[model samples]
Target: MVAGRNVLRALRDIRSFRVVVLHPADAESDELVAQIRRIGCRVELIWPPRDGIPDSTDIAFLLFRQDALTDAILRSLEDRPLAVTLIAIVEAESPTVIEAVVRSGASAVITKPIRAFGLLTSMVLAHKFSTGKLISAEKMSRLQTRLSGARVLEQAKAIVMSQRGVTEPEAYALIRERAMANRSSIEAICASIVSTGDVPGR
Candidate 1:
């Protein structure tokens, strides 16, 4: 539930995207590009560039085997941090190709001979994947904070028991009482006690 609320909100907020399509100009790819434009996205089409990197944008669609272009765009994506999601356009599925796609930071893929039916679905999946990754990172950070707080609480309880010769439960009760009186979290009060090496309100 913690990750759910944020992920759903992100999905709802994605209205229109500025999409970059990197593929050799062809009838099928062209038609797919046109459909994306009709959905109200600002679309840019480029046949892999020779020497320059693509500028950062909301999303990018990469055609496999365009090594130079994919590298350039991935470089740009890295510089921009979590600001872009890549969708790979591939002709067939294989272990090597799928590994390369993910390693390049692609969140989703569209199999080639592009079908209009699944194009939109792929875009949605990419956005969802990106949001899920962010949610996971946030959860990990909170978990780390809790772990650190637990260490602080343990140290504080030890100090209480040693200084007052009380049982562990008694020491914990003392810490909880102090926390309530000071209108702070048990972890915060414990941190103060641990740092000073003394139990307060003795």
Candidate 2:
């Protein structure tokens, strides 16, 4: 229950979150409520039988409370795309227990006695992972740029080695030196050499 302070601290700093604290909604949830005071979220202290729950909840916390563990409700969460990440805190989790919980659509399992910011840290990590979905053009752009550079280098190396009868390593070093001397990126230099078999403007 003292860990409630840690939970609130995490929640307060967060933008918004949906947390289901199963019975006994002890001091832990109480503290979290205070932290969530202005966060525009709902701290549902409920047993199962919840229908039409928001599917976009950022994270779900399971406190080893039975009321939160009915078969029908678990199915509802798992059967939909909303089943992103579930965190379970138990006193001790056996291999069987761990596997079952994981297979039940919970992504992470933490051992309890919830001490020294363990619970809070795990939850934060879970939130990050769930929200850190890829598809950003920045990441794709970097990837594509690297891929193009690699292809250009390969083509340049082939041109240098075939034309000058040198090893690939030597050809690469030569291209790099020329690029550096000209203050151009290796990709730009390689692209020119590949397309024309000679450095542009040289």
TM-score of each: 0.62, 0.45
Give the top-scoring candidate (TM-score): 1
lDDT of 1 by residue, 93-120 (tens): 7776676787777888888688888777
Question: How many residue pairs clash in all the candidates, one count each?
Answer: 0, 0
Estimate candidate 2's RMSD in Å.
Answer: 9.5
lDDT of 1 at 191: 84
Would you list the C-alpha lDDT of every candidate in the order shown?
0.77, 0.63
lDDT of 2 by residue, 125-179 (tens): 6764554433344577889989988988999999988987999999998888888
Best by lDDT: 1
List ranges where model 1 is wrong by over 4 Å: 1-15, 22-32, 44-58, 64-69, 75-84, 91-97, 113-115, 177-184, 195-202
lDDT, candidate 2, at 193: 96
Model 1 lDDT at residue 130:
79
